[model samples]
Target: MKEIRLAARPVGWPTAETFEIAETPVPEPGPGQVLIRNVYMSVDPYMRGRMNDVKSYMPPFAVGEPLDGGAIGEVVTSHAENVPVGSYVVHSLGWREYSVADAARVRVVDPAAAPTLSAYLGLLGMTGLTAYVGLLDIAQFKEGDTVFVSGAAGAVGSVVGQIARLRGAKRVIGSAGSAEKTRHLIDDLGFDAAFNYKDAPVRDQLRAAAPDGVDVYFDNVGGDHLEAAISTLNKFGRIAMCGAIAQYNDVAPPAAPRNLASAIGKEINLRGFLVGNHSHRMPDFVAEVGGWLRSGRITARETIVDGLENAPEAFLGLLRGDNTGKMVVKLG
Candidate 1:
């Protein structure tokens, strides 16, 4: 078995030198455990925070240990009663070709339920759940609301816009880094408007795209985007703070949203959320989002990098905004 481990904590952007690939004997599943051969592993913005040795909602990834996240695999060998051999499952042990985990920690996945096994790592899994909970639960999205999203071409943001539309948002606007992604939001994802933030100042772009003012903001990229959203939000607007990808790799303290005082005047609700905290809503989320997927009212897109050896490149690419939606490593 081969796994990638952190060789050093990155000060800014990580490079290949920060990662090490090592081969080791594969372990057998012990009692109440299962051995999994991972087929797809996800690389996300949040993983960058894990690389730093800091206290967070999730523990930091230790140096010289396998860096793990969402992974979809087949249970090649099982010692537990419920999780049978050959069944597909999703777990949190990724950044490796294979994994050994307690059966209690693995959830069996039905290939019949999703378009593909990798969907479990994206639209049908944590990625989708993040968007769903962020918009509806955290942001308290209401019908006819005008919504805005940052990083709107990425996995979670893409879904947030679509879901907002399905729920009858009056308008949905998005901000992306490139013209291509901005077009994707408008043409493919059905966002009412989208702009390339790099083309102009975020505040100007957002204000132009959302002339009526934004009722809700789903924030995936932070910094300027947050400040812009704060400036453009309507009175009593809500913000679902899902991630801060822009500042994740900063070597020094990143600039704060200078106009945060606007929140007080607007009486805006800005709440940061971790998807894990809203697990209680998973069943409802799945029922609603799953139907949308089946009816073709929503879509899941992924940018896949082949092979376990290229996982670090995929992670680095994700941080570079090189991918449109979910970024996954296809190991099978």
Candidate 2:
């Protein structure tokens, strides 16, 4: 078996040298444990924060320790009655070819229930759940509201836009890093309008796209996008501060969102959230989003790299805005 471990903590952008793949013997399952042969692993933007040796919502990834994220695998061996061998499960022991974990820690998933086995790591997993909770709860989205999402073509952002549309939003707008992503939002994802943030000032683009004013903002890319949304927000507008990918790798603090004071006058309700804190909503999330997905009312997209050795490049590509939706690594 092989596992990828953190070689060093990065100063700014992480390079290939940041990770190292090492071979190790596979371990046996304990009395209450199962052994999983990983088939897929996820690489998300949030994993970047884990690289730093600082305190935050989640613990930091230690040097010399194998990095872990969302992963789905087949149970090759099991000692617990609830988990059977040959069943598939999702857990947090990625960056490795196989994993041994307590039976209570893994959730069995039926591959027949989803379009692909990897869907459990994205659409039916935390990625989809984040979008569901952020829009419906944190942002307090309602009928006929104008909604805008930054990083609108990525995993969570893409789902947020579609849900707002399906739930009776008056309009759905999004901002992406490239022309192709913007086009994906407008033409394929049912977005009312989308703009490439690289083309012009976000405030100008947002003002033109949403002249009537935005009633809800699902912020995935903070800084300029947050500032623009603040300027265009109608009074009592709601904001779900989901992420700030725009400043994830920055060595210095972000300097924009200079118009935060405008949020107060506009009565903007900004709330930051972590999906882990809202596990109570999973049943609701899976039911609703799962219906939309099964009925073809929503789309789940992913970018899969072929091997575990390339997971580091996958993470670097994700941070550079190279992947359009959920970025995951496919393993054998």
Candidate 3:
């Protein structure tokens, strides 16, 4: 088996040298364990936080240790009772060709229901669940509310916009890093208006896109985006602080929000959340998102890299806003 380990902690941006690839013997599954042949691995912005030597919702990845993320694979061998060989499953296996994990930690996936197993790592998985819970439960979004989403063309942001529309939001506006992504948001993902944050100042672009002001903000790229959203939010508006992808790789301290006073004056509620914190609501979320997908009301896009060796590059691209949607590594 081949696996990638964290060789060093990165400063500004992670480089190839930060990872070390090694060849190891494929181990057998222990009692109550299963061996998964990883097929697809998810690369998310949160993983960047794990790479750092800071305390977070999850522990940091130790140097020389194999990194782990969400992965979809087939169970090639199993010592567990319920999970048998050939079962498609999702587990946190990190960067490896195969992983031996407790069967309880993996969930069997229905290949017939979802055409591609990768969807379980994106739309039907944690990314989609995060958006659903944050917008519906945390933000308390209602019908006809004008929503503004930052990092709008990426995985969670894209899904957040579609779900808002499906639930009857009057208008959904999105912010992306490039012109092509802006078009993808408006034309493909049903965002009522989209803007390239690079083209103009965030405050100016948001002002133009949401002339009447925003009722709810699903924030993905924080920093200036949060500040801009704060400035434009209407009274009693809610903000879901999902991820701060913009400042993930910064060496210096991030710029503080300049409009927190607006939050107090407008009675805005800004909440930060991790998907794991809402696992109790997973069943309800899955039921609703499944219906949305079956009805073609929500669409998902993925930027897939072909090999595990390129996972680091794919992750770096994600921080730079280079991907259109969910970024995944296909390790067939």
CA RMSD, predictions in order: 0.8, 0.9, 0.9
Clashing pairs in 3: 68-94
Residue 230 miss distance in model 1 (angstroms):
0.4
lDDT of each: 0.92, 0.93, 0.91
Error of 1 at 318 (Å): 0.3
| Candidate 2, poorest ten consecutive residues by summed lDDT | 257-266
In model 1, the runs with Cα more than 4 Å from the true position are none
Report lDDT (Cα) of residue 115, candidate 2.
95
- Residue 61, model 3: lDDT of 97
User: Distance from true position, residue 242, model 1, in Å?
Assistant: 0.9
Ranking by lDDT: 2, 1, 3
Q: Per-residue error at 152 for model 3, in Å?
A: 0.7
lDDT digits (tens) for residues 1-332 of candidate 2: 99999999998899988999999899899999999999999999999999999999889999999999999999999999999999999999899999998999998998999999989988899998999899999999999999999989998899999999999999999999999999899888899999999999999999999989999999998899999999999999999999999999899999988888887788889999999999899999889989999999999678889999999999999999999888899997
Clashing pairs in 1: none
The Cα error of candidate 1 at residue 10, in Å, is: 0.4
Residue-by-residue lDDT tens digits, candidate 1, 67-153 = 999999999999999998998999999989889999999888899989989899999999999999999999999999999999988
RMSD of 3: 0.9
